[model samples]
Target chain A: MAKKFLQRLGLKDKLLAIIVPLLVLAAWQGAVSQKLCSELILTPPLTLLNTLLELAQSGDLTLNILASLKRVMIGFLLGGTSGFVIGILMALSPFLNRIFGPLIKALQQVPEFAWMPLIIMFLGIDEFAKYFFVAIGAFYPMVLNTYQGVSGVPEKYHELARVFDYKSFRYLFKVIIPSALPSIITGIRLSLGLSWMFVVGAELFGSDSGVGYLMTWGRAVFQIDLVMAGLILVGVIGFAMNFLLERAEKQFLLWREPVDGRPA
Target chain B: MSNNKGTLEIRNLSKSFIVDNSPLQILNNINLTVTSGSFVSIVGSSGCGKTTLLRIILGLENHYDGEALMDGKQIVGPGTNRGIVFQDHRLLPWLTVGENVAFGLDKLNRKEKKLLVDEHLQLVGLIGFESVYPSQLSGGMAQRVAIARALANKPEMLLLDEPLGALDALTRMYMQKELERLWQLEKITMIMVTHDIEEAIYLSDKVVIMSSRPGIIKQIIDVSSSRPRDRASSEFMQIKAEILEEFHLGTEYTFAYAI
Candidate 1:
C-alpha cells in the first residue's frame, strides 16, 4: 500500500514540475504587465517571442545556430578524443602521472575565461581560435574523469582479471574499459556541456558568427528582443544537449541500477 | 609434469603489509600440502588473514615470502592451473553469463569456448541463464557464475575464498551440496576459506582452523565421514561440537580465547 502511495506521489511530483514552469511563465507575464522593472532591464515575454519569430524569418538565426553547433562538434570531437586517450594512458602508467599529472592539474585551475585573451592573441579571433577554446574547455574534465574511472577499478577486479590470465590489451578492452565506462561517460557528458558553454564564451569575444555573435549584434543595435531571443535559444539548446547526453548515459550504463532503485 | 598435475605444496609462506608506519604481520610461517583431488577448508574468524593466504596461493599477492610448489615447480604468478573464485562474484557486470564464463578460455576457438562455457554453466545448474548479465542475477546466482567461470579454466586446483559467504542460509546449503557434487564430478583439488563451521565440515575432507590476528593454523580436523556425510546424524553433530569446542565457542573461556 505504501509503495503504491509513493508511486502516486512520484507521479504527482512530476506533474508539479510541469506546473511549476507554467507558473514561472505566468509570473513573468504578470510582472511585465505590472511594469515591475524598466523594459530595458527585463524585456516582456511577448516581445521576446516576437523577436525570436522575426530572427527566424530573417534566416540569420538558423545560420548562427548552425555555426555554433559546428564549432561545438569540432571542438568536442578533438578535445574528447585526446582526453580519452591521455586519460587511459595516465590511468595505466604511474610514470606518466608523475610527469603530466601536475601540469594538467595546474591548467585546470585557470578558468575558461582566463584563456580568452591569450587564445585571441595566438589565433587572431578566427574560427580556429573558437574551436580551440571549445576543445580545450572540454579536454581537462574528460581526461581527469577518465583517469579517475580507469584507475578506480577496485583491486579485487584486477586480481580476478589477473587470475584469469587476462594481462593483455584484450583484457583492457574487455574488462578495464567496461569497468571504467560509467566514469568515462560521465566525463564525456561534462565535456559536452562545457563545449557549448565555452563556444558561447568564444563567440562573446567578437566572433563574426554564432548565436553569441548575433546576441552581440543585437545588443549593439539596441534590439533587446533579439538579445532575449538569443539567450533563450542558447538556454534551450544547452538544456537539450544535456538532456540527450543524460539519456545516452542511461542507455550506455544500463547495467547499473538506476540510482533510485538501489539503496544509498 | 604431465602425470602429476594436481599436487600443491607450500613451503614457509609468510606475508606482511605496512600499516601506520609499522609492519603488520598478516600471515606467519604457513605451510600446507594437498595431494591430487583433495578438498581442504580453512576456517577462521574475520580478519584472520585466511583470504590473504588464499591470495598468496593464487599469486594475486606476490609480496610474500616462501614458495608455492605445484608438482615441485615454483609458482611465480597466476597460472591457468590454479583457478580462483572470489567472495564476490567478480563476473564483469557488462558481460553476459556465457561471455563471463568464457572469459579465461580466450585461447579456445569460439565454438569450443562456447561449448565449454555452456557445459560448466550446466554443471553449476545455471544452464539456461547464459545470456543473462550479472546485474540480472541474484547474489547466489552471480556467485554460481563466478564458480562456473573458475571451473571453465579446468584448473588442477580450485581456490575459493568464501565463495558462498554472500548467499542466504537456504541458498548456501544448496550450493554446498552442489559444490560437493561438482567436486566429485570434476575431481579437482579444492581449497576453500569460510567461517561457517558446518559448511567447512560438510564440504571439506579436511578443515584447517586458524587463529585471529597474526593468523596461524590452530587445528586441522580430518572429517573421516564418508561420501554424503549425514548432517543430522550423531556423528556430524559430534564433529560440529568438537570443532566448536576447539574454537572455544559455547565455553566460559570463549571471550578470552578469542582475544
Candidate 2:
C-alpha cells in the first residue's frame, strides 16, 4: 500500500523536476546576498550570472568551449571507430581473442590515471599527450559494448547468413554490424561521456587552453564565479549531447516496438 | 514454372551428438526423396529431430553420417539454392520488410533487386508493406515476410521449420491456405517441418511421419487429394486419424488441423 502510494505520488509532470533546484538556488542566493556565506567559498548568484555573460560577450567562453570540444571530438572519433572494429574482430576470431583479450582486461584493471605519468614522461605535456589520454578513456566502454553486441548476436542470424552464403566480409558488414548497431550506439554514447570527462581532466592537468584550463585559471585568481560558469556549461552541454543521441537512437530504431509508450 | 532442379535425396542420413560425453543419436537411417516442384511435410511429435533433419537438408548441420543430395550434387554447406524460414520468422528487426526481402541479393543490380523484392512481396500478398517494420506486423504477417524473404532469393527449394507454429489457430488455418497457394503459384519444392498432422494432409504431396527416440521415418503417406483441400472431409479426418495413431494420440479425433 505504501509502495502504491509512492508510485502515485511520483512526479506527475516532468516539469516538476525544476522545482527543487529552483528552490535551492533561491535559498542559495538569499543566503549569499546576506553574507551568511563568504563570497570566496560561494559566489553570489548575480555575480555568477554577470561573469557568465561577460565571458560570453568577450568570446572567451566560446573559445574555451571550442578548444575543449575539439579535443573531445577527435579523441572520441579515434577511440570509438577503432574500438568498434577491434571489438568485432576480438569476438569473431578465437586466436586474436586468446592473444589480446586477457591482456587488455588486465590493463583495464590498472587505474587509467596510472597511465598519465608514463604518458607525460614519453610524450611531454603537449596536445598529442592530452589527445592520447582522452582517447584511452573513450576506448574501454566502446570496446566492451561492441564486443558484447557482436558476440551475443542471436544464433538465428548466423543461420540466416549461412543460408545466404554470405562471405566473411558480407557477413560482418551486412548482418553482424547492423544487428549489433543498438549496442554500438550505447557504446558510442558512453564513450562520448568518458571522452568529455577525459578532455576536461587532460586540460586541468596540463593544457594552457579549454574550459578546464579556464576553471584552473579562475581558481589561481580566486574568481569563483568564472569556475561556477564553467561547471554550468559542462553540465548543460553534456545533457544536450545525451539528449541528441537518444533522439537519434529512437529514429534509427523505429522498427522496435515500445512498451508502455516508451521506446524499447 | 516447373524446372529440372530442387530434387532432394536423403540416403542413410544419421546424426549423433556428444551429449554429456556420450554419443546420443538424434537421427537414424533416414531415407527420403522429394522431387522438383513438390510439397513435402515432415510430421512427428516433439523430440523427433525433424528440425535437425531439415537443417541437414538445408546444409546447416554438416556432421551427419550419410549424404543429403540436391539435384544430383552433395549438399555440403548452405547455398543460395536453398532458403529457410525459421520457426520464429527470424526477420532482422532493424530492417524494413522491403530491405529484408532484398537482403540476400548481393549479386543483382539495384533495379533488379528492387523488382525482385516487389515481385516476391506481391507473391506473398504483402506488396504495399514495403516500408513497414517487422515489429509493426502481426505474427502471421511477419511469417509472410519471412516467406517473401525466402522467395526473394529465387531458391529452388524453400525450407520451412514450423513457420506458422507461433500464430493463432485461425491465422494458422488461413496461412495453411496461403502456403498451399504459394507452393502452387511458385512451382518450387517446399519442405516444411510440422507437428500438425492435418496441416501435413492439407498441403503436402507426401507426409513423412517419424517416430521419436532416434527419429526415423515410420511412414511416408501420399495424399493425392485435389487442390483447395477440404479439412472437414472424411478423407482428411482419416489421414489425421492415421497420423494420430502413429503418435499414439488417436482418441481426440477433433481437428481442423489448425490445432
Candidate 3:
C-alpha cells in the first residue's frame, strides 16, 4: 500500500521529498549560530548563499562557468566520438579487439590523475592539457560500454539480419546500433559524469578560470563561504547536465517498454 | 496469384550434430515433396526434429545431406524467396508494427515500401496498429504482425515454426482461421512445423508425422476434407486419431477429450 501511494504521488507528496534536506539545513544553521566550529572552517548556508549572489553580480561566476563549459564540451566531443568509433571497430573485428583490448584494459587500470604530470610536461599547462585530461577520463567508460553493448547483442537479432540478407553498413546502423543503443546511452551518461569530475581535477593543477579554480582561489584566501558557493555551483550544474541527458535518453529510447510493464 | 510458383522438393534429407564427440543424428533419411501453394504441416512431439527439417528447408541449416530444392534451384541459405515466422513473434522491440513489416522490403523504394507494408498490415487485419510497438501487442497480435512481416517479402514459400504456439486456446483457434484465410488469399506454399495434433488436422492439406530417436518420417496423411473443416467432424477426428495412434497417444488423447 505504501508503494502504491508512492507510485501515485500527488504534488503535495512530491513536495515532501524536499523536507529532509530543509530540516538538515535548519540543523546546520542552528549549529553555526551556537558556534559549533570556527566560522572560517564552517561557513553557514546563508553566508554561502550571499557569496553566491555576490559572485553572480560580479559576473566572474558566469565567466568561469562558461570557460569550464567550453572545456567540457570540447573534451566530451573529442573523447566521445573517438571512443564510439574505436569501440564499434573493436566489437566488429576480432583482430582489432585482440590487438587493442589489452592496451585499453591497462589504460583503464591506471588512474586518470596519474597521467597528469606527464601530460603537463608533454603539452604544457595550457587548455590542451586540461582538455586532454578530461578527454582521457571520458574516453575509457565510453569505449568499455560501447564495446560491451555491441559485442553482447543477441544472436537472434543477428540471425534476423542474416535472414534479411542485410548489407554490412545497413546491418550495422539499422540492426546493431539500434539494438545496442540502450547500452551505448548508458555509456554516454557515465562518460558525461566522468567528464564533469575530471574538469575539477583538470582545473586543480595550473588553471586560472573555472569552477575548480574558483574553489582553489577561495581555499588559498581562507574564504570558506566562497568555497562552499563553488561546491554548490558544481553540484547544481552537474545535476542540470544529468537532467538534460536523462531527458534526451528518454526521448531516444521511447520505443523501449519498461521491463516491469510500466508505461514507456 | 500463381499457384505454380512455389514448388518444394526435398530428397534423401539427413541431418546430425556432434554432441561431445559422437555424431547424434537428428533427422534421418527424410523425403517429402510439397506442391506450389499447398499447405503442408509436419506434426511431431518434441525432439522429433520437425523444426530442424523446417530450418533445413528454410536454408538456415546447411550441414545436412541430400537436397532441398525450391522450384528448380538448390536451397543455399536464407533468401527473400523463402520467408519465415518463428514460434516467438521475434519482432524487433524498437520497431513498430509497420516498421517491422517494412523490415522485409529493404530493396523497395520508400514509397513502395510504405505501400507494401500497409497492404500486408491490412492483410493481417492490423490496419490501425501501424505505430504501435511490438511490446504493447498481445501474443496473437504480435504473431499477426510476424505473419505480416513474413508476407511483406512476397516469398514463394512461407515457413511457420509453430507461429501460433504462444497464444491462448481461443486466440489459437482464431489465428488458425486467419491462417486459413491468408493461405487462400495469398496462394503461396506454406510449410508449418507444429506439435498440436488438432492444429495439424485443421489446416493442413497434408500432415507429415515423424518419430523421435533419430527422427524419421513415419507417415504422411492426406486431409482431403473441404474448407472450413469442423473440429467435431468425424473426418477430422479420424485423422487426429490416426496421427495420435502413430505416437501411441490415441487412447489417452481420446480419454482426455472425453473429460
TM-score of chain B of 3: 0.97
Task: Tell me the interface RMSD of every candidate, in Å.
Answer: 3.1, 3.6, 3.2
Error of 1 at A26 (Å): 4.4
CAPRI-style docking class of model 1 based on DockQ: acceptable
lDDT value for candidate 3? 0.90
Ranking by TM-score: 2, 3, 1
lDDT of 2 by residue, A40-106 (tens): 8998777888898999999998999999999999988888878888899898888988887998799
Q: Candidate 1 residues B105-215, lDDT tens each?
A: 988999999899989999888989988768788888888888899889889889999999988999999999989998999988899999999899899888988887788
All candidates: DockQ: 0.43, 0.59, 0.47
The stretch of ten residues in a row with the least summed lDDT in candidate 3 chain B is B250-259
User: lDDT of model 1 at residue A64?
Assistant: 93
DockQ measured for candidate 2: 0.59
Tally clashing residue pairs in candidate 3.
Answer: 0
lDDT tens digits by residue: candidate 1, A1-264:
855785676757677678778888778877978988777777888778888888789998899999999999999999999999899999999999888899999989998789888988889888998889999989988999999999998887787778877777977897888899999999999999999998888898878899899889889999887788888999999999999999998888877753556210
> Quality of candidate 3's docking, in CAPRI categories?
acceptable
lDDT of 3 by residue, B1-259 (tens): 4757888998998999999999999999999999999999999889999999998888888888988888978988998989999998889989988999999888889999999999999999999999998888888999999999999999999999998898899999999999999999999999999988889889999999999989999999999999999988877888888888998877856745833
TM-score of 1: 0.88
lDDT of 3 by residue, A168-247 (tens): 89999999999999989988998988899889888878799999999999989988888889898899999899989999
